[model samples]
Target: MSREFEFAQLLRAYRKGILSEKAFEEEMTRLEGGACGGFIAMGKTYASERDAIVAYLQRVRNGEAAGARALEQWAQVCKTDCMRSGLRTIAEREAYHVRVIDRKLNDLGARCEPAADPEIDRFVSMQSDPNISDLDKLRRITSSFANADEVVKPIYEFVDLIKQDLDAKEMLALWAEDEYSSIKWFLHACAALGGAAQSPADSRHEAMASAQTH
Candidate 1:
């Protein structure tokens, strides 16, 4: 049977409650293949309207809404993978990295004599707190880094390395055994950092302009 027909059959099974959402999504992923697999699965998995899955997949593949949706779906998949793999919780993992990076940045800041910012101080403290979620700590770290003029490059490099070490597809595969939200957030963070690195100067200029305007 054609892919569309197969997908349609899956959708019917999904709507009839013959297949759970997770199972339907996995089957779609297996059928579609590649990075696009997630998007296809997402479209087929969550769609309620007739042909909505097909339309969404087409939009995604055509370089329109697919990129954002795919990213979102990929993130969800990542969260699921992390939990199944028995990997360190994202919060724990990020907290560890944040502490390491924050310490290095703090030492650098001390040596450089950059003006102290309370936000940065709070961020450093948060990095070691197991109470805060990884996503929240990451936000705090990014915000704190942005507030500092001298620490910006170091922070960017640190985050860039973390982003580089992550393989979205591989990560997703790990969570393929289950579904979780944390992995999705992790993937989103990685994508955001990757996008930021690809245009650092532009982002800096924009930040500078925004700072001036404010």
Candidate 2:
């Protein structure tokens, strides 16, 4: 690839969180001044881009698996028609993510390791409780994320980093968008129910609310 193209890719990777500030600077220096160096590892924990992508996929798979369970239970108990519908849709989506990630991990010749998460378990319990109001559950969900970007930033950053595994990259891109959509819907639902956050547009509310009757 041309040095200019490589430079643009490096810039994109840095912006996406694939490359650290230090690594980006180093690559920039190399490209700009024709300095000789090897490829620097991407993350603090992983040795290469594949390692980072695999690790990230593992983490996301675990979280999404747990979230799928919690959302399934929550949907069962959710009293609000609109919120319940959305919860079911999101639950299925999370479950699908787990399946796809698992397949990707298997294709990469990696073992699927189950990691224990106590906080996720607690959240599942709270979500499944029939006594808790839907609005309260919405608040609990939205409160965990400081903002919409907080929900999908890691996914997008990780997606931007992958160079060779186009399949995984594309899946992650869709996964990030799905996550973003779910969070936005939750935030809007929370706000529409008289929560403190700003409500989404009437059209969004209408679209989600329509799901209840279908």
Candidate 3:
């Protein structure tokens, strides 16, 4: 059977509850044959790796743009000197990432579709609220992931699946490393604010500081 027909059958089975969500995802991953690189590209399936990359880049572009805006707004409201500096630095990096990703999407002959995310809107509002302490905002953001590395692990995994798209793979690999640095900073900032012991971010602080200077 064709991949399309097989995907349809799987979708029907999943919808009918014949397959659990995990099983359905595994089957979809198998059907894509690594076109999606075994990672759910924003929870959708694509027939080809290029298609998946195009869609994934669009999603990342959107998310990074939102993140940049949110962090900038948070920086404005943040009262702490160090937190404000770090927030602005991260915001700038996120904006730069979006620009590069947008260029890549254009090279692939695709335009980003404007997708509004309500969760992002709420997050921006929360982050920008002057009444919220910087520690609280740090807690809110860092709490989403179990650890710093968890945030960027999927990006590296996806990069590994790119068998032919060396350009995209290299780009994503660098992007993942950047995200790792940002998350490490966030975790360390949170810990310091909460009076917890010094975290692993201490070792990487010099690197993050170097990034800020750039």
TM-scores for the candidates: 0.19, 0.74, 0.72
Q: Could you give candidate 1's per-residue lDDT for residues 1-214 as a string of tens digits?
A: 4568778999999999999999999988866652243322332433222132223223322221222222333334332232223223443443343343334334333212224456544544554454654445345434423323343333233223221123322322332222233434333343343423323444543443343334
The digit string of per-residue lDDT tens for model 2 on 1-214 reads: 4567888899999999999999999878866543343323334545445666677787778889888998999888887776777789999999999999899888878856888889888988998999988778888988878778887887777777666568888999999889998898788887767665454557666565555347
Model 2 is weakest, by summed lDDT over 10 consecutive residues, at: 34-43
> Model 1 clash pairs?
60-66, 75-184, 76-184, 78-183, 79-183, 79-184, 80-175, 80-180, 81-174, 81-175
Model 2 regions lying over 4 Å from their true place: 1-45, 199-214
Candidate with better lDDT, 2 vs 3: 3
Once fitted onto the true fold, the runs of candidate 3 whose alpha carbons sit more than 4 angstroms away are: 1-45, 195-214
TM-score ranking from best candidate downward = 2, 3, 1
> What is the full ranking by lDDT, best candidate first?
3, 2, 1
Better of 1 and 2 by lDDT: 2
Off by over 4 Å in 1: 1-111, 114-116, 141-187, 190-214
Clashing residue pairs found in predicted model 3: none
**Global lDDT of each model?**
0.39, 0.78, 0.80
**Candidate 1 vs. true structure, TM-score:** 0.19
Candidate closer to the true structure by TM-score (higher is better), 1 or 2: 2
